[model samples]
Target: MTDTVLEIKNLEASYGSVQALRGVSLSIQEGTIATILGANGAGKTTILKCISGIVDPRKGSIHYLGRAIGGKRADLIVRMGIAHVPEGRQVFPLLSVRENLWLGAYTRTSRVEALEDLEAVYRYFPILKDREKQEAGKLSGGQQQMLAIGRAMMARPSVLLMDEPSLGLSPKLTEEIFTIIRRINRDWGTTILLVEQNASIALQTASHGYVLESGRIVMEGPCEKLFQDEGVQEFYLGQKEETGVERRRWKKTRKWA
Candidate 1:
């Protein structure tokens, strides 16, 4: 049986007057990929922020490896083996690609281990190695996304929190990025909590899924079931199921034409 690596219970967070997460609870088993599906302003990112200590929760518990980590310092959280790749691929533009990656290892105590991990990141993204000395801002969107993931990997995290990794990229590039994500999980046995707007890809990539709406978890299940759900089909996948009456009407209208 797999162990629960990360767990969140009754997670509540806010941004001043606005309540972001409302009693959110979820758990991820080790070596598995879980996904959070939601629309804009659905409090998905807030959950990540709370876990990573970027935003303090009003009330709740976040446990990683059986240790309570909610509201801990952000850097401390990273040192505890949870790494977050925020949305928008926030790589330092003026910094060299190598420099940006090196910053991820600041939490580590061993220089030699960090150096080895840096080389591993280069192996994961050879393009980054080719441009190690180049300014990060000079790279394209997909390259920057790779840089972001690679930088996060430099920490050798046990749990990777990825937010909208496919944001602002071509279809092909999105596929490529997800391929790397799968590779990372399979090779490193890293647990992943992915928050993605692209429902089709998210459902395909993650084994378990949770749907969020207006700061609450509305549905939770295996991705296979969620993919076939009528509401999910209509709302997230943009593919609505045709009722018998609707199908008959469509056939009648087609006959007239």
Candidate 2:
């Protein structure tokens, strides 16, 4: 049986007085991709932050490989093999692409492994290699996203938490990013927890899914079932399931039918 790589119980977090996560709990199995679906301010990003130690949970337990990790330092989490590709592709604008990638390996003690990982990242995103010397700000949006993922990969993480990776990209670029995401998971046996607003793509990409609303988990199931859920179809998937009357009306109005 595949082991649970990360687990959370009753996770809660907030900003000032505003609660962002309310008893949020989930688990990701080894070598699988799990996605959280929600709208903006639904606390999707906050969950990722809590996992990667960017935001400390107010009340909860976060476990990685059966060890508690909540409230740890962010850099310590990275060193513990959890790398976060945050929302908005926060690459250092003034730094060279190579420089930004190297920063991901700051916790590693071995220079040789870091070099090898850099080459591996280059292989994953050859565009980054081509733009190695270029300032990160000079690259296009898609390239910058690639750079962000590559930087995270430099940490050689066991679990990768990706937040809105498809955000701000064209359809083609989004597809490209997800393709690489799948490849990373497949090739490296990486357990991934993806947080996304694009429900359609997120459903397609992940094996298991959770739906968050108002800082709480509203639903969860296998991706296939979640994709077919009426609420999910209507709200998240942008699909309106027609009632019998509506279907009849639609059929009646279709001259070609």
Candidate 3:
């Protein structure tokens, strides 16, 4: 197996006349977490969409496991070993949790394989197991997000693309979600490319990081080192220019059920 999981060269994507990604290129190594941090409209989600084959890039190439995957259909990319957990945690509201999870592996070769995938998901999130027959719409936001991730896992993706998995969750639930993400990468060796608004935890958890502003990469480096950077402090770390590290931790309450 190759150490390099994903590579993009001079990638360009646009929505009509408005360009979102402008000649952006990056690499993700196997079994590592790569995070892209940017404000809204900075083309973070657009990049993932292009990688997952939902959006066609106007220029450049995307290589996954050493094969060109750009411009393919979304389902084709899913079968090619990339699973996407979109920003909204867009689970099927009317369906039961189990049914929604089942939909994730509709292209699996056999029922036995799908069952095994279900077992893997249950192991990662026992909470979903308890709510198997419950309506997905009735679940809390955090539970729904967990279901989204579990559904993605059913695809058995080599690379997981997550967009704003922390959105609309309390600080406590956010922490829990990020913890599970880190555990997933550590235990399963799943290469994850994450885009998050919560830069504090996102930067802390990722192995490598890229800072995007207005669709351009301003800085890129390892997470721990970037944690101490002045730009990361002023922007991501959520500190004032004059304020030193207060050694304060984000308060996480009891919320993940």
Candidate 4:
């Protein structure tokens, strides 16, 4: 069996006249979390959009579990066992927590298997069970994020693409959410491709890392190597005044997307 769960080569995508992903390529091994770190408008999200088939790649190929999927439809991709939980935690605000979770299984082939997966999700996140009847919008930010993940879990995906899972969250909540992500990876063995601007924690969680700058991969290696490098301080650790004005410039540049 191929150790690589996903492979992207010569990926290029554009919206109108504006190019987003530019000749990007990446490979993700099965049963590991691989994070793509970059600043806002750096095309991190565009990579996810392309892989999930939200935007068709203008050029290049995407292979999922050895099957070419670059041109497939988004829904078709999800049913193929790739679930994308997009940037904004796009939950159904009006729907009940239970209803939102149930909707995730809409594409599943068997209702019984979907129900079994729902139970598994509840085991992973008991809060969703506690708030089963609550309106999704009424939940706290952390609860809402949990619901978003829970909804994705209901789809029974083998590969989970999470975009900015900790966006707009408190530090405590971010830690909590990342802990769940770790458990999900270790326990369920689902391969994950996480896109985030929070490089510090993201690198710590991922087995390997890739650093993206303005739609291109500028650096990539072992997570520990990138973690200790001085360059990582530019984006991950925040800049330093001792390094002078050029280094000070990073303080103003928004990294979050």
Candidate 5:
């Protein structure tokens, strides 16, 4: 039997009057990577924020490791073994690389264990090791992304929530990051819930996928199945060879649900 490590059911959230998530529900199995694919403003980031307790859900339940964690504080959620690597690589620019990574272990009780985790992060990102004393802002965009991910790992989380890890990155850098993400899941046994606009890479890296549109889950299935789907091929993967007219016609007739 597949063990579900995280589950979000009928989740609803909003920013003031603007509703961001409308009953979004999904589950991630233990020790696997799950990807959420969507366009901008589709509430993909909102889901991760809700899970990480950065945004409070107005309704629904969030379960991690069979425990209810809805409405918990963000720091409390992190201490409960979930770490969120937020969008836009929000590393503290003024802090040194080592200092930024050390902050991820704020919830940890043992200093020795935190130090060991820091070494593990360095192993995954050797560039970070070389720049340990340098200010985080001095690094390039890709290096900052590496630091963001490494800092998350320093938390020693069982479940990692990553939002738009490929945003603003070159293709080569994006590939490298995804490769490291796969390695993190495979080698460290950490379950990941990844939100990405790069649908092709997300589908390829994850074992299962969910498609979100306008604050709701529109479709979901195994990654291979989603990759081969005609609509997904056209809308997400750019695999459709049809002319513009045919594309419009298909959209007019297609039912997203």
Candidate 6:
């Protein structure tokens, strides 16, 4: 079997006349965490949308496990072992936590196996187990985010697409969530494609990284290289050296594509 789990080539998409992704391409290796980092409106979320079938690519191809999956329906994609934990932690407000998690296994037929997976999810996020019968809407933001991830876990995906998993979270909660994400990757061996604005946490969490700017990939490399790059340090990592010297030096040396 090939090591690459997901591949995108020349991907282009838009909303009406406004283009969101322009000739974007990237790859995720099996059993590794990969991240896409960019500012707001940089087409970060759009890439995840296209992969999960929420939006169709106007051009190019998306291959999952060496098979093209660009135009498949979202539900079909989920059943094919790709689960999406969307940007906004979109949990069902009125549904009990247990009910929401069960809905994630809607594609599966074996009740016994699904129950076992449910127990595993509880083990991963013990708080979800504590709030099993509570209304999902009543949970704290951090708990709700946990629920969103738990819901995706119920699908038992081979590849997990997470968009802005740390949005609107306290620093402590964000660290906790990312810790769980790392454990999920290492323990379950699930391939992940994470999109985030929190560059520091994301770069630290992922093994490899892609930097997107205005709907295009500007930089791609291993996490350590990205973390050490002067440009990345100044722009993304919030490291500003004395009197803006490093910032100016970065601007002079780097050129965008």
Error of 5 at 45 (Å): 0.5
Candidate 1 per-residue lDDT, tens place, 1-257, comes to 99999999999999999999999999999999999999999999999999999999999999999999999999999999999999999999999999999998879889999999898889889999999999999999999999999999989999999999999999999999999999999999999999999999999999999999888898999999999887787678987456675443333221111
Query: Which candidate has the top score in TM-score?
Result: 5
lDDT measured at residue 42 in model 5 versus the true structure, 0 to 100 = 93
Model 4 lDDT per residue over 1-257, tens place = 53999999989888899988888889999999999988899899999988888999999999998999997999999999888887878889999999999999988989999889888888878999999999998998788888889898888889999999999999998999999999998988999999988888899899888888777887877788888766777556685447565655534654432
Ranking by lDDT: 5, 6, 1, 2, 3, 4
Model 4 misplacement above 4 A? 239-257
Question: Model 5: which ten-residue window has the lowest total lDDT?
Answer: 245-254
Roughly what TM-score does model 2 have, to 2 decimal places? 0.94
Query: Which lDDT tens digits does candidate 6 get at residues 1-257?
Result: 63999999999999999999999999999999999989899999999999999999999999999889997899989988999999989999999999999998999889999999999999999999999999999999999999999999889899999999999999999999999999999889999999998999999999999999999999999999999987788678888666855446534554554
Residue 5's lDDT within candidate 1 is 96
Q: Tens-digit lDDT track for model 2 on 1-257?
A: 99999999999999999999999989889999999998899999999999899899999999999999999999889999999998989999999999999998888899999999999999999999999999999999999999999999999999999999998999999998999999999999999999999999999999999999989888989999998887788678887656665453333231211
TM-score of each: 0.94, 0.94, 0.92, 0.91, 0.96, 0.95
- Location of the lowest summed lDDT over 10 successive residues in candidate 6: 245-254
Candidate 1 ranges with C-alpha deviation above 4 Å: 242-257
Q: How well does candidate 3 score on lDDT at residue 174? A: 94
Residue-level lDDT of model 5, residues 166-214, one tens digit each, is: 9999999999999999999999999999999999999999999998998
Candidate lDDT scores, in order, read 0.93, 0.92, 0.90, 0.87, 0.93, 0.93
Which stretches in model 5 have alpha-carbon errors above 4 Å?
Answer: 242-253
Native-vs-model 4 lDDT? 0.87
Error of 6 at 196 (Å): 0.9
Candidate 2 yields a Cα-based lDDT of: 0.92
